[model samples]
Structure formats: C-alpha cells, structure tokens
Target: MTKNILISGASVAGPALAYWLHRYGFTPTVVERAPGLRGGGFAVDFRGDVHLRVLREMGILDEVRRRQTNMGNQVVVDADGGQLAKLPASFMSGDVEIERDELSRLLHERTRDHTEYLFGDSIASMTEDADGVRVCFEHGEPRTFDLVLGADGLHSNVRALAFGPESRFIRFLGYYVAGFEMPNFLGLDHTGLMYNVPGLGVNVGSAGGKTDGGFVFPSEELDYDRRDLDAQKQLVARRCAGAGWEVPRLLEAMWAAPEMYFDSISQVRMPSFQRGRVALVGDAGYGATLGGLGTGTAMVGAYVLAGELAVAHGDHRVAFPRYEERMRGYAEGCQKLAEGAGPFLAPPTRFKIWQRNQMYKALSWRRLAGVFDKMTTKAARNITLPDYRPAPRSAVPRESA
Candidate 1:
C-alpha cells in the first residue's frame, strides 16, 4: 500500500492534501523551500457549493470565515483621481474571502501535528522503481516514499524533475503582474482604488494603515531574473513612468516595500497530471496565476486526489486515472475565466479601457445584479464531487462514498 506519501510545497495544496491523507490513514511528508510559512499575498476567495463543501469537510470553514478579508468594491478612477466606475464586491470577493497568507497558515496548522514538514529544504531529484519513489533533497538526505506528488505550483521544481522543463507547459498570457504591500497613505478601509492608462493598471486595496498593491500591464514575455527584487521594482517603475493619480507614491512605496511579488500572468497546461506512482495536485497540474478560481480549485483538487487514493487503496494505477478524469473539465472551465483577465485589467488602447469602464458601470444597475453575480460565479460550479467519507477504524475506506 502507498501509505507513505511525499508532497512538495507547503502552501495551500500540500498541507491540505496532508490533512486528508492523514485522515485516510496515510502518512504524508511535506517539504517546502521556504524557511517557514509565507505571509502577505493578495486576497483569495472561495465561491460556489463545491468550494464550500470541501472547506466544510476539512472542518476549517468557520475559522476561514472568521479571518475573511471582507474586501469591498473596487472603484475605477481617472488620471485626475476622479471615480469612473465601481466593480462590485461579488465580482472581486466571493461568498467568503480571506488573505492568501491567512488561508495558508490555517491549512498548515491543521496538518502540522500529524504530517512531517521539512522546511528550508526542497526536492533535488527523484527516481521511481516498481516499489516506491526515491527522492533527494537540496538540504536533507535522500529518502524513498510510497508515492510522490508535485503540489509545488506554477514553476514546480517537482514538475521539472518528473515531467519536463517549464517551457513545454507554461503559457504567458501577454501581461505581467506585480503585487506588494505598503503603508496606507490613502487611509482607505476595506475598499480599493484603481487607475488605468492604455496598457497599464494600478490597484491599491487598504485596511487601516496597510495596503495590498498590484500592477498589471500589457507586455510581451520579457527576459528578467525572477529572483531580483530591485530589478523588478525598476521594471514596474519603468512601465508605469510618468503616470498620474498616486502612481508616484505607489512607486516610492514599492521601492521601500519589504516583500514584493512579481510574475508573468501565466497558466500551466498538461496532458496528464500523473505519471507512474508520482502525480500532481493544484497549480502543478492546472493553474492560472491570477483571476482564475485558483485558490478554491487547488483546495478542491487536493481533497479529490487524497480521497481517490484512499478509495483505490493506494494503488496508483487505479487512483491516478480517476483523479484526472474528474478534474480536467472542471479545471479547463476555470482557465477559461482567466484568459480575459489581462486585457480586462489593462486594456490595449484608451478606447478599450473606457469601454470596459462603461460596461462594468452598467453591471452596477440593480436589475442587472443577478446577471453580474451569475457571471462571476458560474464557471467555478462546474463539477460534482464525491462525498468522500473516511472511516476512523479503516486504514483505507473499504467502499467509496
């Protein structure tokens, strides 16, 4: 039986998978490259019945709700700082929304006691045989596990080792994004302000004296060192040069910001998520970096994978195919929602930006509220999940729920 499972990356998917695997009587080890849990990312929301069901099954729904960001509407503004249109909370925040870091911390807490976590280390290499998968770590000694999963996200190290180089799978969506946190000079509360020019957009959401900041700009895939902080700030500064309505102030804050996140808006597509006894979950298999229901999808994907393993009695040949069959279509639907995000955030021309603002302005009409709500939420409700009920006395559930 594949009782010992190794999961790479300690973010949402890894800890979450560990939680279910332990409940199903499988021992799970998680290895993360970060020294500890990361904090301060843009907000992530859970929408629809499927997302709520998974969160409820994990028994963390109440806690997640308690920590919700409660983010309000986003106001579009002109260069002179005049409000143009308002984007509703329903479109921005789902039924429940929380900061990404808050969700990560909560998931980690739930699984830390029973799951083995190897922080400050990462998978260096892997080799599979008929019995199990042998794994080596960058900082720790090599070991073998019954199965291995690449929960490690978009540019997954595990995917590199097992699948192929990243170029084959990663598709840049004609835009680059940068997010950071800074002092809330605007003194905003629960709301945010957005200002846009042709090919560029800046959004700042604040609560009290802190802000969650973001910039989306149209660009061809540009070459840059992913690890360089100052260079990233400079690139953003250059793209947004001579901009108006708090742009200079945000740029100043970006330079002084302690933590910054920058990336090309991209998606990962794969033919299959499983190869041999090794598999993938969350962003490693299917992901859109932003605007997609990525956070919710990852959590649900983790639950499905772990539950299927239990159902198949750790026989990967039986479990892996079932996992892919259930998730592929659902995953593709979510990806479709993300394809337009870049253009929506930063339109290619002045007329397009104005047209977008006007279109959303019409969405605010009371009569159209229902239509707006359904548009934002429908793609996320594309699947029906099996009710996986793990029994306390059984090592693996004898019958699937």
Candidate 2:
C-alpha cells in the first residue's frame, strides 16, 4: 500500500495536505526550504460551500472565522486620491477572509504532532522505481517514499525536476505583481484604496498597523534570477518609477521593507498533474498567480486528494487519476477567472480602465449589488465534494518510514 508520502512546500497546501493524509492513516513528511514558517503574505479568503465545508471538516472553520480580516469594500481612486468607484467587499474579501500566514499556522498546528516537517531543506532529486521512489534532499540524507506530491507554488522545484522547466507549463498573462508592507501613513481603517493609470496600478491599504502596499503593471516576459531579491526589487522600482498618488511612497518603502513579494501573474497549464508515482496539487498543478481564489482551491484540493487516496485503499493508480478527474473542471473554472485578472486590475489603455471602473460603479447600484456578489463566487461554488470517511488506522496497512 502507498502509505508514505512526501509533500513539498510548508505553505497552505502542504500542511493542509499533511493534515488530511494523517487523518487517512497515511504518513506525510513536509519539506520546506525556508528556515521556518514565513509570514506576512496578503489576505486570502474562502468563499462558497465547498471551501467552508472542507475547513469545517478539518475543524478550523470557526477558528478561521474568529481571526478573519473584517475588511470593508475598497475604493478606486484617481491619481490624486479622489474616489472613482467603490469595489464591493464580496468581490474582494469573499465570505471569510484571513491572512495567508494565519491559515498556514493553523494547518501546521493541526498536523505538527503527526506530520514530520523538515525545515531548511529541499528535494534535490527524485528517483522512482517500481517499488517506491528514492528522494534526495539538498541538506539531508537520502530517503524513500511510496509517493511524492508537489504542493509547491507556481515555480515548483519538484515540477521542474519531475515534469519539465516552468516555461513548458507556465502561461504568462501580460503583467507582473509585487507587494510589501510599510508604515500606515494613509491611516486606513479596515479599508483599501486603489490608484491606477493606464497599465500601472498601485494599492496602499492598512493591514493591522502597516501599509499593505501592492502593485500590478503590464510587462512582457523578462529574464531575472528568482533567488535575487535585490535585483527583483530594483526591477520593480525601474518599472514603477513614476506613478501618481501613494505609489512613490510605496516604492520607496519597498526598498527598505524587510519582506517583499514579486512574481509574474501567470497560470500553470499542465496536461496531467500525475506522472508515475509523483503527483501535484494546488498551484503546482493548475494555478493562477493573483485573484484566482487559489487559497480556497488549495484547501479543497488537499481534501480531495487525501480523501481519494483513503477511498482507493492507498492505491496511487486509482487515487491519483480520480483526484485529478474530480478537480480538473473546478480548477479550470477558477483559472479561467484569473485569465483576465491582469487586464482587469491593470488595464492597458485609459479607455479600458474607464470601462473597468464603470463596471464596478454599475455593480454598486441597488439590485445589481446582490447579483454581482453572487457572480463573484459562482466559480468557487461549482464543485461537489466527496464524503470521505477514512478507515480506522488499525484497519489500514502501515509501512515503516
């Protein structure tokens, strides 16, 4: 039986997968390159029945709600910080919004006792045989596992080693995004402000007591080292050199800020998420960088993958294909919504920006508000979760790790 599993990434997907895998009488080891749990990511949210149901089943829904970010609707503004349109909270915050760090911590807390987490290490190579897969780590001893899963992000190390280079599967949507936190000079109270011009968009909002600064600008693909943090920041500064409103301040803070996030707003298009004994979940399989409902999707995918494995009696041949088949359509629906995120958030032309602004303004009307709220969540609610009851641990076959 395929009882031992290795999951790459300690973020939302990895830990969440570990939790479900343990509950299903499987042993899961999570490997993270970061020294420990990295924090301070933007707020992620869950919407619809599927997302909430999975969280509830995992017994974290109420805790998630307790720590939810009760942020209100965002205000779209002019170059001078004048309000243009109001973006409803439903479109931005979803049903239950929480910081990515909080969600990661919660998942880790639930699985830390049962899951083996290897920090400050990474997978260097994976060699699969008929019996099992031999895995080598960058800073640890070699080991073998029955199955390996890449729950890593868009630039997954496992995917590059097992599948192909990222270029083969990543479809760059014509834009790049960057975010960091700084002092809250704007004094925003549980609200966000958006400023845009042509193809460049900037947002500086309050998160706790700091300015949650973010940027999205249209750009063709460029060559850069993903490991070079200073170089990435410089690139963003050069691209977003001159912008109106709080952009200059945000850029300046970005240089001094301790943690910054920069990546292409791209989507992963994989023909299949499984190959031999290796499989992928979340962003590693089908992901949209920003505004993709990725967090909620990752939780649901973890539940489905682990549940399918339990139902299949720890057989990869049955579970892997079943998991992919059940999740493909739902994943595609979420990714489809992300295809236009770049253009919608940072429109190419003034006319396009005006069109987007007008659309948001229209949604603010009386009857349209309710309809718009539902429209934003339709794709998220388009899935039927399987009712999986894992066999008792004593009834399942066990393998030594």
Candidate 3:
C-alpha cells in the first residue's frame, strides 16, 4: 500500500524527507507555518564525505558548492577593534558553507513538484489509532495519514502534540543567541569580525553585500514571552547594554532590522524518536541549538528515515525503530559538540574569555588545526549509510481515503 505521510515544518528536514518518500513511492504532504520559504539567516556547512555523498545523491552538490559563501578568515578583535587573532576558514567553514535559507529554498525547489506543500498553516493536534493518524491543522481542515513526521525543529509543535511538553525533552545549555540582518555598515567583504567581553560577544559577517550578525550571552533559563518580538529585542538590548566595539552600532541596527531570531542555547534529547504512527526527524528529534552539526545531521536523518520506511514497506512498527537505532549514536555525538560552544563563545568571566582566545590562536598551527579537522570529520562520518533502492512500482501499496 502507498503510505500517506504528513511532515511538519518545511525547512531542511521536511522537504528532504518529502523528496525521498516520493522517490520511494509514498505520498508526502508538508505543512509549514511560515507564509512562504524563509530567507537570510546564518550560514551552515556540510562536512566530510558522508554529507557530501548525500548531497550528491540529491543532485544538488554542485549547486550548493556554487553558492558557497567562500568566506575568508575570521578575525578576533579587541575593544578598540585591534586584531587579537585570526582563525582560518578551514577551521570554521568545513567543506562548504551556504546560507540557511538558501539551502532550505534549494531543497524546497527540488522537492516541490513531487510533494504537496501547505504553507501558512501548522499542525494543531493529532489522534492515532491502529491504521493511521488523524491530524488537525490550525488553519486547514483535519486529515488522516498513514504516518506523521515532525521535522519541525527544536521547539517542534508536532513533538509537543504527539509526545509531551517540551520541558521533558529540552535541556538548556545556559546561553541565549539572537541573529539579525544589518546593512554592511562596516563595509566588510567575504569575512567576519568577532568581539568578546566577559560574558557576551558578537560576530558579524559580510556576504553578498549584506551583513549577518548575532549576539551571544551567558544566562540561566530566562522568563520571557516566546512570541513577543518587541520584548525579545528589549531583552537583547538590555543584556548587551554598554558592550564595547561595534556592539552599540549593531544594537542600533538590530532595533531597526526587519526580523530577528532568538532562542536559548539548548538541546532536545528524547528517549525515542517515535511513538505509534508519528515519528520525528532532524532537530525535532535530536538537536542542539547551535554549534551542533544540526543542519547536516538533519539532512542525514531525513534520508535515513525515508529510506528505512521504504525498505520496510511502509510499516512504521518496523521502520521507526530501525531509523532511530541507526541515528541515535550519531545524533548524540553531534549534540555533544554544542556542550562547549556556550562557554567558548560567551565565557562567564573575563579570565575565561582570555583563555579561550589564546586557545583559538593556537589552532592556527598545522598540528593543532589537524586535531579539529579529524574530530569533526569523524563525528560526521560515524554512520555508514545504506544503499536503499527505490521499491518496485507494483510493490507500492494503495492508501485509504
């Protein structure tokens, strides 16, 4: 029977899953809360051979490489903007770095013809029985599907509805980050500047004539309204008050920027990725807020989830566990990468900040640089992907309306 699958969130994981599921002869319908594809966010990279091979399978490797930021070295600067040290591109860019929105758009375009996309809507509730899951959307009619997947990211509405409250699965890593677009006020080109002070820091990078910037600060769990953009901006402004370097100017730009992204640096660790007919892929399943190779991991997990389902002939009882087993170790390893990022980016004390700066400078040495390269490569290459062929046309099952 052809299983009908509904995937939430039209970002990286959702569309990738749709592509694979369609190739495997399943029907996939994706619902996204956003009005349309999003644009302009931080850059994300694909590392090692594993990630490269998957992109090749999707036939977008060359396209992605063509869109590479080709960013140069990043300079760490002091309060007066004096260069403290330089970190090479290889240390940060990995194999290739593309803007988040660009990658998402490319994936959507690749899968659009084969997938049913419902934008400007969200999954509001779900009820599961022996054969399928009945889902209610906030802005559309309720429907039932053979399986439901949550590719909806860290604060996934699907996960919340299907599994439980986010508190049970989310772990705060003691920091908050905000990113926004600003004019190329500094006139930087294809490079980045970073400034740090005790418990706060800002990184601004120039690309394609525009600047992408962020503020990171150490904090305990904060009590704030998640839906209040104005309040979020005010909180960021207050936390960054009196910061030196270009921070004041950056704050000014932040205040006027059209959109902003703010969230606690956190990870989602679930005991199992699926329950009944509903499953999760990407950050919705195993995710770290930042520094975790989440974008790459999401692509990988989406590939595996669809492939496993196809291989198991659309039986969630068999496919979901296999998918989880294949991904668990790799996902955990990726999540661990985020553990040090909070302290490294926004150390709680001035002495720690100085210590981190000195360590980063040492990474310039060939031997020291090789250590990070090997570590990241190993993390990305941990799982050997299976060669999953498309099922025969006659093998596809019929779905019940």
What TM-score, over all chains together, does every model reach? Answer: 0.96, 0.95, 0.96
Per-candidate local distance difference test? 0.87, 0.87, 0.88
Give the residue spans of candidate 1 off by over 4 A: 208-210, 391-401
Over 4 Å off in model 3, which ranges?
Answer: 392-401
Q: What shift in Å separates residue 348 of candidate 2 from its native position after superposition?
A: 1.7
Candidate 2 achieves a global lDDT of: 0.87
Candidate 3 overall Cα lDDT vs. reference?
0.88
lDDT of 1 by residue, 1-401 (tens): 78999999998899999999999889999999989987666888998887888899999999998888778888999888789999887778889988887799999999999999999999988999998999999999999999999999888988889999999999889999988988888888999898998999899997534578889998878888876888988999999998888999999988888778888899999988999988888988998988889999999899889988888878889889989998999888998899999999999899999999998798778668668667657778787787666544344433222
Per-residue C-alpha lDDT of model 2 across residues 99-161, encoded as one tens digit per residue: 788789989999999999999999999999998989999999999999999998999988998
Encode model 3's per-residue lDDT on 1-401: one tens digit a residue.
54799999998999999989998889999999989986645788889998998899989999999888888888899999899888888777889988888899999999999899999999888999887888889989999999999999999999999889999999999999999889998889999999998889789998656689899998879889987879999999999998999999999999998778889999999999999998999999998878889999999999899988997888888889989998999999988877988888888888887888888899877799889888987888888788777666345323211
TM-score of 3: 0.96
